[model samples]
Target chain A: MAAASAERRGPRDTIAVSVRDVGMVFGDVHAVRNASFDLPKGRFLTILGPSGSGKTTLLRMIAGFDAPTSGEIYINDRPVSAVPPHRRAIGMVFQKLALFPHMTAAENVAFPLKMRRHDARAIPEKVERYLELVRLGGYGGRRINELSGGQQQRVAIARALVFEPDLLLLDEPLAALDRKLREEMQLEFRRIQKELGVTTINVTHDQREALVVSDEVIVMEGGLIQQKAEPVQAYRTPANAFVANFIGVTNFIEGVVAARDGASVSVSAHGCTLPGVAVGEALAGGDACAGAVRAEQIRIAPRAETLGNLDTLVEGTVVDAIFEGERIVYEVRVPGLGDQLFRVFDHDPVNHLQFSPGDSVCLGWNARDMHVFKK
Target chain B: MRRSRAAYPWTWRVMDGLESLAARLWPARFEKGLPYLMLAPAVLLVGILVLGLVQIGDSSLRVLDTSTFLMSEDLTLANYQRALTESFFATVAGRSLLGSVIVTIVTLIFAFPYAYLMVRTPSSALRKFLLVALFLPFFIGQVVRAYGWLIILGNQGMVNEALGLVGVPPMRLLYNYPAVLFGLVQYMLPFAVLMLAPALTAIPAELESAASSLGANWLRTFRHVVLPLARPGLVGAGLVVVTLSLTDFAIPAILGGGSQDFIANAIYDQFFRTSDQGMGATLSLMLVAVGSLLVGLVFMLFGAGTLAMTGGRK
Candidate 1:
């Protein structure tokens, strides 16, 4: 990966680019709304969303392509509402890899320096230095067309970083590549963003790409930030149904919060008085929310478990089962929620699980693992 | 226009005409040569035009005075030498050439961006408006347009009237090089825009956005990225503009007020007014030769630009 070969050298890492209340209105369309965040130096922040979810629009405001309709942006604590994109010292890698086709690799990297009116004498050395940083040292004299897709992407990175902009912006950088190439580039990008100690913001729809690279992930939907958290936290304890469904596969059971208490709660769900705790906020009965539980959280067996007394346990028939290479997924039939599935890792099927589509089994998990919401 | 596949029904009148014509015309043509007979009109036109140009060249080489149309057909250099030595004719050529080159350059500099913007701007309504607005001048005759400019720039017209209001004296503007240049640009802006529009439109929007996001904003992006990619369109626009302006007669004739007549007008004078058909033919052929040379230079310099603007000849 280019980033691995790059040498780590820069000032102490800190927050450099901060976006506060950033929103953009292109005519009647609100492309982005109320987007407030800060990007720290030497770290990567991946703003992830599907198309039209506003991640690209937010990145544009950072690059100064469009000013927020009502917001302020800051680069190193200085509010840069009035600064133009070229003057803002922000490096951006477009999805198309926007390398100047007419110029060779070295000249493409040298463009930003020329724009900044840097000494022409030092441009050649500066070009070599950044090209080396991206592990594309010898490829500098080549035309952009001569390079591979991965190599062209590296050249684009070399170009953006050559300017040594305070913040580097990547707009769906790996989106155009095939799945294997994308995964390969994802690691390379994370490494390069780290090695240069340049604060980077990546925008993508690929969840795995976001989880694998970003120190923090911000998921956006419908021009609003759905949630912001580290990958593990967002995965395990999503704040809302959208967040839960967006992060990873989760089983959702409609429930009502019958009671509330500190750190834990009891819920009446599936026509039964069940016990659960709020994953985000305490809720009461009749509130509109959902209870989400991971598939693997439910342990299914022919017999009951030790937590049978305190566990949210129910006896249900295995509606179906599918062997998914590493795990077995059993679509267990619950009385109220119909057929909600439970997954168990297939370490060895002989010792752990055995079930047919119609066999009755007890699905159960501890109350601590039961995430209840008012809906 | 009739659709290609549909055929007219076979009726009695058609059958009679077909039978009679085939009996008379098709009989001889089938037995002899129908293909050459069919190709005659177009071939004859081309033949006449080429032979006419050669005859003009031959006439231009012969000796001539008002007393006799030509003293000799010996192909002397006197007519060519006399044409070269005449300051009035030479000055007309120089001023016309220089003025047109400047006008075309300025027209392209201003029109190309507008053409590009008209095409790239997101709203289809706006693009349509721009397209229609660009071609609107086409419906108006150059003579009428030239007269309109004369009023606007004349001493007692809108331009002088505005200057008078600004506490400056009304100055002579009509019947000058500037007036002529302005008239020519107005006459040719639409053509320049038309030549450039398709080329500019053909350059994908992904190209410029790609550049801007790469740490290069509008100006740097335009200079390095958009302009280079649009180089072909620029060349095409230059060729069209230069060609039109170089041979422009009506605009210069009206606005130049006899001070800035070009080769077109000079050729017309030699052929019709001055009764020097040989000199007029020489001037006309010179215009074509210079135009061809300029076009050759355009093709050599900006290959893509020529291709984009003029559709590199098949």
Candidate 2:
């Protein structure tokens, strides 16, 4: 158990939440396996994963809704493995928002305070304050169904945070919102989290949301924590192929590592040698590997001379060109790389020459842009 | 068109020809009226019921003449007057009303957990078992079930046999008000559970989790979250159980050993045993009014719950 050690460490570490070797198994299925992490006080963390990636199970365990089959979870230097969810000072916003339809926004916010035995005299004021904080000041009298979708979300947040729990867990509350509302709420969440300085853990499958909202992101797959790092680090230097593929639109070129030079490796794919940066593990000669390159990192031009000075350049025919508002994405098939389609993002779509499908184009990227990992 | 029809099977061609013929007769312009046309059968059935009620009402006002063995030429309020003033009638009416209320409350209390378990149980086998148990009673008619209780709670029954094994003598559990009420509750349990299941299922399981995570213990969660959200189901189930128990005749007839009589049994006794059609008609009209008034009160208090066909909250 992490109890004795956590007690010895005491309040000196400033660790608000410490999950140690937590694992949850449902019958024969391992939902979460040997998950461990320490979240510093006042920091926002997100467990990022695909639908069946055990992110929710991990969050549930930390929130005390679930008892981990093994290991313990500590909240502010106290072991909470045996604590029930209500006894544990944790607030959660559900995926569906789960606002009580019968109660008004203020009443919903006042619920936790009432249940937690807060002072009856101070409850109305506290509920008002939290509702206002969520920017739903005068909307308190409105029933949950009476409010708009975004307003309902604010009410849910206020309700969760009104009791001032030790930690806040968000079980993908914004997943149900439309894209525009979701993005707006993401920034709103970030602002409130910063304003309150509550140690928060959010679970989401939306990669962009994880990157946008969290100070740290823990990526999981197959009930295993694949990578845990700051958002930029997780994005720029993924731990393994799963993290690399999961985070963003990346092209994976299957190959064998020809040689390793410090942090960089040269992978020979289909008789073409591609220079790349090694990720997760060092690659020896003849080790099967895949070099991952981000869509934005690759530059596409009409001809070889048009492509700026780069370490590697390949001539390929444009397969498809998609016009996405801010950027133009072109899928290019490079014969030199064995007809593998390489995606290139044109951020300055207005200034760039838009290449149509079947047009021959030159794609180039720096060697450091490609992350080489063992297959 | 001929080539397309020729490519199809004989069944398909026949169906297509029928569809085209029907379309030709119906036409697209009359589509708006189709829904109302479909409602004709239900409306006609209700119209027939209203006509029957009118005849009953007409008979209810007429006094029965003992010497002639026929209704009097002139209408009167004699039956109503007797029904309102008589202690026997008062006791039966009071008993039915009070018994129905108790049965509704008890049935709802028992059904909430049953319906909740059926909806929320994680194990499919357990859910299936609960569903089967809830529906199995429906297969046996209410009258048959009352008889089953008569056998089970009788002096020489299984329950008394078990009690006798402990040196306790067989008790007179039948022919009492409690026995009738007990029989009614058992008969109403399935209807209550059936009415409640959908309402309970409408409530997302996540809300409970949300409630617990928001610092509500399971008991508090049930009180504050589950109970409030399941109001529709409770109201719906309560309304059904109350009305069904109120009008019930078989349970009181069989289980009460002729001592306990509900409104329906009283109506039956007047129409058959006493040979008073006017009294029977009066009781029948009163029962209809009482049932409607109860249902109306429920709608007024709880907005018709799940039974309200209106689109949800404004």
Candidate 3:
């Protein structure tokens, strides 16, 4: 298999894909506007967004399916805006998998090799190698409809990578699978991508899939990239309110900045002062601001005195409590913070006492966990 | 299980009354026969057709006595023997068969691209324009369309008049085998396209894009992927066009100038012009047998393309 040789040649630290000021407009609607990003070799970058957020448009442009209206895209520093999709050395697993229903799994895997006119003698060995790469060694002769959905997905992946293209694109191939299979395939894709060290760009609306599979996640909204960062940085330090609201369940506290100290700022809302880390644009005193804190970042205690060694604490009453299998989510309405309701997740439910509705509680979090942004 | 009737809603009571009334009118066993009851009219219509065919079969065995202008009382195979032996009937049958094959091949070749473009075009106006052009001939009768072609293709017609302006002599473009074949093709184009459109539409656009991404160019993609996937539509459209053209009478009657006669034209002459019912009935039965044999051959070779009558396992 070429996989062993591919692994021997480790991934190089060079820019694999570069998009410069790309824009796409269809009649009156601006589908993608002023998008730009660079992905290094052998890294997995996922463009994450909701439907109609231009993520798919951007991916299509990169794949040479759609031409950008404004700027150019480069594969290995060569501008490819004029190249046709067939000529481009890129493999794509479509949103629907797009496996040919008429062909057997082996034929499906052999298509790219046949199209590229690989050596006639080497075709079968290569096909079998890729089928084995996808862990479908003995089942290559089965037609597409005879295979399960997950097996069909493996066929698509193998077919896309059979030619050993310079770059691979995944267009939400797991969006239709059930949750368990989707998660399993996410890990499977990550493993295959790493093993082959193929530069890949995946587009998906599922944020969890993005975080699980991608080395970097690019969050998009309304035809613009809101933030592009590593998964941890994106989850911990979102660039703006959209990224914060889109990535995870976050509670926003609307207030005015009363004090600013380097990276930290104090925001006053409903006559209560709260400390938070200042992110994005600089903030001056009396400037309108919003504080974002993730549900898991905040801890809920039975009393204010019980939660010690925290940066900020506020007393509130539990307005609602939902018991999920792994964790319990509590919605607390703080009286001192503009009567705002904050969600806190209790991960250690067995060790910690569960607070029911109408029970008095205290919500506490570190100042670094709260991201303060200009409203 | 019996529940209190008074406890149920008024709607339930009304439904119950209707159900009991139905039960009294039709026994429960009759429910199983409802589908066959609905099929009775179609079956009766076919039975009547079979009876007429039987009568025709009997009549085709008798010879017409020209002196008395009446069929002979004694049955014989004279009509069939004469039809098989006559050179005129052989020429007509051969012309019809050859012309139908040519027309079907030409029509399918033209209709496939037209149907594909109509189905794949992104512009709604273009698709609507193609659809309107296809159906416009349907609004005009086949005979009228054939005559329209005659006027357009005749010497000193619109085309010849345009040619005259260029200082060229008026050419006889109508009333020939080519003209008859051309008319048949034009008439059958829409039927072929209509039959093929649904099958083409069943192909998802993603498959094309997928093929292109997998390194097949547009032409290769069409040849390898689109063409194979559209086999059922092609076969179905081919069958319809072939049979329709083989039995067609109007195009040859109007465009052939009485020189190129199809099977239906010959049958018409046998029944109406010569008033030979025996010969007409013989020719009619032969036409049916020929069409059915062609269709049967197709089903055997292609396994009912796009009909999907086969088991799921293939």
Candidate 4:
């Protein structure tokens, strides 16, 4: 709430993009509902959502690829709803990288400049500078297919940024790469974005990428913007149940609100009441709700007595245990919590005694970590 | 697993048995030679063609004795010399060359948008309609289509009848150079579209979007990106249309009214009407040389991939 208020009060001159009640309808299907947001200049914003979540549709609307069925979009305080994509000064790195296979690396990078009719004498120099920016300086003579996958990505980035567009849009450019290379490119994208200070919007389904590269994150679902906040704020305090569940690995405990006190609510599930923070809307006694707890927030132990500092504790049997190098995931069915399977992440795997399938265990979490939302 | 195998359908069992029998008969050691063995029929057919071409070459070097109505015993260059220097043959060759080139250019201009629309249309029904319209002429065969055009474009035919309805008099729309070229274009339209559709489909649609997003308008996008990328298709379609039009016999024979004789019609005239086998063979060899030269030129300019010979790799 504070961050949103700060965004509204950031002054008109600083806002690089402002979308007002933008809606995109395709026949009978509304691909994007009324979405409104303000992105401050030089801030990297990532719209994160799973496939078919309308995140790409929203980005396409902002890039002028698809006109909004309602309202308008302002880029640097200019209404650009009627402008065609070519007329808008926006660079986009498509999902497939869409590098012109016919052009050499330097030629591809010089494409935008040539199209925009930049001074012919300066195209080569600008192309070289952008290639160097993407660490492909001497590779200007190489064709697109001649480069490796990562090198092709660099060529695409150079091509997009060489023209110095007002906005840079990345449409899951790293989605096709291997994990190690994707992580490297993610950092590279952030460094270059920060260096260029271009107001950018990247659409991706990668939550870690959204958190790693963006100054702000917008989580969308079912053609609607569910939450728009800083990455940490979105992770720490999601606006609703969907945002909480979508952004991270979370376990939901179904219950009815037993009592409410200020910002916290006690949810009665199985035979006991669990304390949790109420998010998004107010709740009262007898209201149906569910408390969402992050998997890492829960601690697992062999005995119940050892979880002394936890605000809530329950006994369970390990249904499955997965050893995932850095952390161990234990799926525990807690009988005290109606035999519902609860996932608990143990961060300290080397020091802790690992639990195996069918082993008796205890799960514990604090009230602050569990966010309760009305059903 | 044994019980499942026993429970398999009779067709599956038969297929399994046949496979094992074939493996035992042919064996894995001979697997490398199987592909070569499969190509035997095509090689044999081409070998026969090469032998016939050699026969034609041998005959082309001889001159026909018109008085005795027999080819001369001794080989000579008289036939080749006569075919090259004669004004009649020269006019026919020049007309065929000019006509084929024009047909190629005009056919490609017409086929490109048709193929592009067929490949890019979002509606399956529209694509199906375009495909059906393109292939419908192919089913009607070239000779039959030329006859059909003859019926429509004749002096008192449907086209002239319509013009007559406007009180413009039944003007001659057939038996001319334009009529022959128009017939060739109509005959080659399907071939051009079929050749170009796959090439257009191979290009990723995103490349066009990328071009537009990079500040190129629709026309610039086509010139800078789509046109260059679709070059292999254009070159290929052009080659097919030109070569086919150059070698065509039926369209000119039906529509030319004996005036607009293409090279094929001239060769037919030498062999049948004039009873000059040596001259016909000479013209046949010359046509092959011209076609080969044009194909060689295209390959030199745009590599073998222009015909998709080397996987169309850039």
lDDT of 1 by residue, B1-314 (tens): 35442365648558877889877967864856777778899999999999988988887776657777654656676767776898987888798779879998899888977898898888999989987887777787889888888889888999899999989999998898888888888888898888777777666676676566555678777888878867777787888788889998898899988777888888888777877766776777778888888888877776646554355321
Question: How does chain A of candidate 3 score by TM-score against the true chain A?
Answer: 0.95
lDDT score for residue B291 of model 2: 90
| Two-way lDDT contest, 1 vs 4, winner | 4
Candidate 4, residues A82-150: lDDT per residue as tens digits? 999999999999999999999999999999999999999999999999999999989999988899999
Ranking by lDDT: 4, 3, 2, 1
Please state the CAPRI-style docking class of candidate 1.
acceptable
Candidate 2 lDDT by residue in tens digits, A161-255: 99888888999999989999999999999999999999999999999999999999999999988888889999999989999999999999999
Q: Score the docking of each candidate (DockQ).
A: 0.26, 0.72, 0.60, 0.81
* Candidate 2 lDDT, B137-182, residue by residue in tens: 8899987888899889999998999999999999999999999988
User: Which is better, 1 or 2, measured by DockQ?
Assistant: 2
Q: Candidate 4's residue-wise lDDT over B1-314, tens digit each?
A: 99989998999999999999989999999999999989999999999999999999999998889799999999999999998899999999999999999999999999999999999998999999998998898998888998899889888789989988889987889999999999999999999999899889989999998999999999999999999999988999999998999999999999998999999999999999989999999999999999899888888987654576666485
Tell me the number of clashing residue pairs for each predicted model: 3, 0, 0, 0
Off by over 4 Å in 3: A1-12, A351-353, B1-29, B308-314
User: What is the Cα-based TM-score of model 1?
Assistant: 0.79
What is the fnat score of candidate 3?
A: 0.66
Residue pair clashes in candidate 1: A3-A192, B232-B304, B232-B305
**Model 1 over residues A1-375: C-alpha lDDT tens digits?**
122112243556455877777788988998888877766666688888889998898888888777889889888999987887667787888888777777898888888888777899999999999888878988888988888999889888888888778888899978899988889988898888878778888899988898999887888888888777777876776667777777666677776676778757776666676666686554755665466767767777787763366467877788778787567878787764545455533334565347888997787777777676555
i-RMSD values for every candidate model: 4.0, 1.6, 1.7, 1.0
**Cα lDDT of all candidates, in order?**
0.78, 0.89, 0.91, 0.91
Native interface contacts kept by each candidate, as a fraction: 0.42, 0.84, 0.66, 0.84
